[model samples]
Structures are given as structure tokens and as C-alpha cells.
Target: MSAPENTPQTSLVHSAYRAPDGFEAFPVGIHHASTVVFPDVATMRSRDWREKLGYTYGLHGTPTSFVLEARLAEIEGGNYCRVTPSGLAAIVMINFALLKSGDDVLLPDNVYGPSKDLSRWLQRDFNINARFYDPMIGAGIAELITPDTRLIWTEAPGSVSMEVPDIPAICAAAHARGVRVAIDNTWAAGLAFKAFDHGVDIVMQALTKYQSGGSDVLMGAVIVRDKALNEQLELAHARLGFGVGMDDVYLVLRSLSSMRLRFDAHDAAAREVAQWLKARPEIASVLHPAFEDCPGHAFWKRDFTGAGGLFSVIFQPHFDERQTDRFVDSLRLFKIGYSWGGAHSLCVPYRMAGMRDGWQRQGQLVRFNIGLESPQDLIRDIEAALMAMQAD
Candidate 1:
């Protein structure tokens, strides 16, 4: 028989080249695939996407994504995990997984802004009832839970206003009423606080922050200790097709080892800056959970192991919105931005009165995401910004 000659197109489409096995390295290999291969029809038919025993399709997950998910779950003390495109997606997935039309969900008044918006949306279009409760309601939350209530969403120390809530108390109340609780634990990056240990049923983390360290990746994960709960979330995950890119997964894996170190550095630097602000005449209060003045500080002291880099400051009632705006703009190293848990410091001004109910504080609120910069340098930058704000 004559040897067959392959055409250029045919050769390109089906290459005989294959890398040898036993190739080991420190980094996890990035595996990108939409169509996963199967040995036979029986194997394909036997594989279940929910089980995570084997891969069925790229959307479900690849080896790279599976490794990332396992690592995240391990970090959060969870048994199962699902990664989403953004933190908001993780929130939505939880809502869709547990909630249905006519079901009610309780959210803290100081919840993340976009989460509040998502609640409004669910109420308007999905027939789901979303109610806002006081973040410090604690065991008082039992009075608010109706038979229709299915889920309760909490943000430890409300992201913007920085009021740490009593997670154990709220969880106790919710569990008594057969309601599950989910928390946005991004602020701590699953390092400082153990959400699961504190009674949170679902732990949602935004890997975009400390887990990415570089602030270049946008990813979120929902982790749960209960297998049944994870199954429900997996169904929603599959329906939503919340597949994350392999490259981004690899990036998170690379940063995971250094997350705790970076997180602690941020904590030290932030405390330094916060302490400086506490004594300044221009500041009213530093809303850090570690500080005594912060609401729910007692709860924080009782439960939390450490505080991360995020904290907010209220200008001494005298500094109006205009002046506070100038203070934010005058900063040299602290850039104006949203989100935190990166190498760069960020400052953002928020009008609290409108955002939360019963927010009677007199000062304009400015949030600080103290980066990995020298605390002295950050304080100097803030001092210069304060000087510029008073220039006129």
C-alpha cells in the first residue's frame, strides 16, 4: 500500500503532535476547552456534571477551573464551590437557586449597593419579595422572618457604611425559622473571618480583590458546606452558564498562596492610616470594625480574627459634600475608584443619607481601600489632600 499524503488543511486540523506525560511544574496548567473529549458513549452517559467526578463540558469546568474552585472552597472551609464571572453573578445565582416567585428574602439595609439594586429587580420582575432589615438587627431578625422568607443576605460590616453585623445572631434566628443565610465575605477574602464557622450557610467571595492581588481579574465564588445546598446552587450555575475563563482561574491560583500575606499587610497599613484619621480634627469617626466607635464593634471583637484594609471615614460634619469631594480629588497616590483588595489604594465618596435608612449622621462619608503602600506615605497623601481641600 502506498503511503497516504495529508493535505495542508487536513494536517492543520488534525495534528499528530502531543506533549508527553509526567510533565510537572509549580504552576497549574491552563486548560481551555468548550468541547471535552470522552473515551466512549458509556463514559459520557455515566458522567454527571453536578458530581464534579469528571468533566462533561467546558462550561461545567475544566481542570484549571476545578482546581481553582477546590482551592477557594478549601479556603472558605466549604465542601463545594462554583465560580462566576463577577461577585454580583454569585449573588444572583444564590437568589435564583433558593428563591422563587412569592418567596421572600431579607437583606440588610447596609447591603452592597448593587445587591440592593438586584433585590429591587427581583421584586419588580420576578415576583420575589425582598425586604431590607437593620444590619444590627441580630436576634431581632427572628421577628421579621415570615413563613415566605427563604433566604437572608448579609454583608459583614455593610460594605459602604462599614457596620459589622452579628452574623451568629442573625444565623441563629434565620436557622430557627428554617431560613438559609448567605454572606458576601469579600471584605475579608476568607482570611480574617471564617464565615462558615460563624454560621453562614453560603460564603460568596469576590476573587477580584486579594485573591487576584493585582486587581486584574474579575471573579466570584459561592461555597457551601452542605452537599444538598451545593446541588441546588450547581443547578442554577449550570442554568446561568456562569463559566469563568481558564486564564483568569490560573491567575487566581497564582495569587492564592500570597493572599494572606498581602491581606495582612493591607490590614496593618489601613489601621495605621485609620488611626491617624481618628485624631485629625477634620474626621468625625473611623468606621473600622476594629475601632470601638464602629457599630457592632462588639460583635466584630467577639467573632472576627482580624480586619482587612477596607474602612470608611465620616468628615467632621463641618466638611460638606463639596469639601469632601475636593478631598477625594486632591489625593495624589490614593486614586478614585471602586472595589478593593488590590495593590493600589482607592478612595470613593458616598452620600450615605440616601443610600441607607435612618442614616442621620451629619458628615459626608469617604471610604478608603488602603493599598500596600507605606502607611506614612498614605497619611502624607491624605494630609496633602486635606490641605488642598482647605485651600479655598
Candidate 2:
């Protein structure tokens, strides 16, 4: 049946479907969309999604995602940014974008565990070669770079072991050989250290940690200052069909505003706790980048403005795995878990003997992710746990 003249249908379709355009707000509007409607076929055909001139689909870009991307890029001093589902996914995207069969990639021996695993997979399935290098090698890394090397991966204050590398020196070596350098900048959160200023070509971070202070969101970002490199990443990112939920993007955006404050607070608290642990009788060594004894403390002192709340302590030589577990189980405030940058403290025990070459530590390793808790109270918790273990 034909609609009556001057019907309400036209008003509803026009007004409800299209809200007024000039509305302003403190927060960006949550633009949830899968398919975007074009004004006409001509506009749709003329739009180039690659240039970010306009959005083509939900996977490509949305206003909310774009806002988050822009803010993150600004913070990291990069020109372009791409958000991924998880940090590891960002790593894989970089690998896929930059590497192919027979190409070689260099990784720090103390690299993130899953990244090492992914490199192994790439070697097996794609015929790419993966080589592990010493985190402290710095410019000496040039000697290890073969003619086939395309990328060199660096991790500051190496994962779990807590050893900072000379990033500028490494970047110099990598760039001198025409090899791209990608750093896992999660620990620094782009605030402590300037990746771009140090000559790094790409900076990848796990936004799930500091960026989403609540630990309720899992997201990652790949940022690049170079337009050509950004274009390469953009093509691979779009082809991989990596789409993040709008709600998570909004959560990260909210957390990002207070990230600097939280990071400084965490840094201060962790240093206090690490120093307290250093004075303890049970700790064999404290692997914190701020301390003189840490593997690359000199480089850290030279490069970073601050450190994160993550650090590890090696127990006295006599402590066994079972004994260490007992100590960890005795803690009340610090829970045993994986991942960090949450409000609650976390602890994880590691057997470091087999993780890398030239295993030097003689005791159990315990990593702590200090949260927004009183340093004294955290120290008491550690004391109580040590007493409990000693009593047992």
C-alpha cells in the first residue's frame, strides 16, 4: 500500500537515522558500525580507504578507533598507528608485513616469550630464519646481522630478567645495515623512553598493560613515524581482518588520560619495594634496571626517564622450586597471576636456568608486578611470606 501524504515515516527515517551533526562532547562518540552508508555511489567509489581520507568498513577504521589511534600516535610521537586485538597479534602483523621466506630476523635473547615462540613458528612454516642475540650487545649487534637480515627486535630491560639494552646503539647498528628495528616498548609505555628519537623504525606496545590501567581490556598498537612503513603495515593489517571492539577501544581511551600519573606512581612504589627487597637477607640479587647491579643499569640510567612496576628478585641459592612456591602461596596481597598493570599486585616464579644462554643465576626467580598499594604494606607481605617459608 502507498504511504499517506506527509506521513511520519519520512520524518522518522530522516531525523532518527541522522542526528544533528554539530553536537560536541568531552569524549568521542562511540561509533559502532559494520557497514557505513555513502551519500552516493560516486562518493563511495571516489573514497580511498588506504589514505584514511574516509572509512570503508568497520575493520578499516571507525571514528572511535581513529580517535584512540590519533591520541596514541601523538603520545608516542609517531605519525600513524594501528590497533590490534592483542600485543602478540601486533607482533605477528609486523612479522607478516615485513618478512617472507628465507628472510632472517634478529631477536633479543630476553625477548617476550610468545614473540620467541612466534619466531620459531615462522621459521618452521615460512622458511624464515630467526636468530637470538644478546640484549646487551648494542652496536656490536652489527656483527651478527647477515646479508639476509631484514628486521632486528629489541626489548628494553629484557622480559622477566629485567635487563635494559642500549637501544640507541642497537638502532644505530640496525639502521647502518639497512635493517629495521622494532622494540617492544610496553615497559616504557612510550613515556619513559622516546623510541623514535632513538632511531627505532617501529614501536609496538601492549596497550592491555599501562594504556588500559584497569587490566580489563586487551589491545595492542603498532606505531610508525615513516609514511612508507605505515603504508606497508596498513596493507597487512587490513588484509589480516584485525578488528577491535569499540567498547574496548573506549575503555583504553579512558585509561590513557591518567596513564602518566599512574605510571609515575607505580614506578615510585616499585623502586621502594625493590630497594627493600635488596636489603633483605633472602634475596640473592635484585634485577631492577634502576639499580647498579642490574645487567644494563648504565644504559637504563642513560636512556629512560622512569621505570615500570615490574622487576624480579633471585632468592638465596638454597631455595628450591617447591620452597619458592610455598613462599609465593603465602602472600596475601600479591596474587599469583600472569600479565600486569592492574590495580592488584601479582607474583610469578620462574626457573631462569634454561630460559637463556649462560645461565648465571643460582636461585629461584620471583617477578613482582607492583600495583597501587602501600610500599611498606607490600614489604610486610613479602616479609610475612618469607617468614612463612622459613618456618615451613
Which prediction has the highest lDDT against the true structure? 1
Segments of candidate 2 deviating more than 4 angstroms? 1-17
Model 1 clashing residue pairs (backbone): 157-163, 157-164
| Model 1 lDDT tens row, 92-120 | 99999999999999999999999999999
Considering only N, C-alpha and C atoms within 3 Å, which residue pairs clash in candidate 2?
A: 157-163, 157-164
Q: Could you tell me the C-alpha RMSD of candidate 2 in Å?
A: 2.1
What is the alpha-carbon lDDT for the whole of candidate 1?
A: 0.94
**How well does each candidate superpose onto the true structure, as a TM-score?**
0.98, 0.96
Q: Report, for every candidate in turn, its global Cα lDDT versus the true structure.
A: 0.94, 0.92
Model 2 compared with the native: what TM-score? 0.96
List per-candidate RMSD values in Å.
Answer: 1.1, 2.1
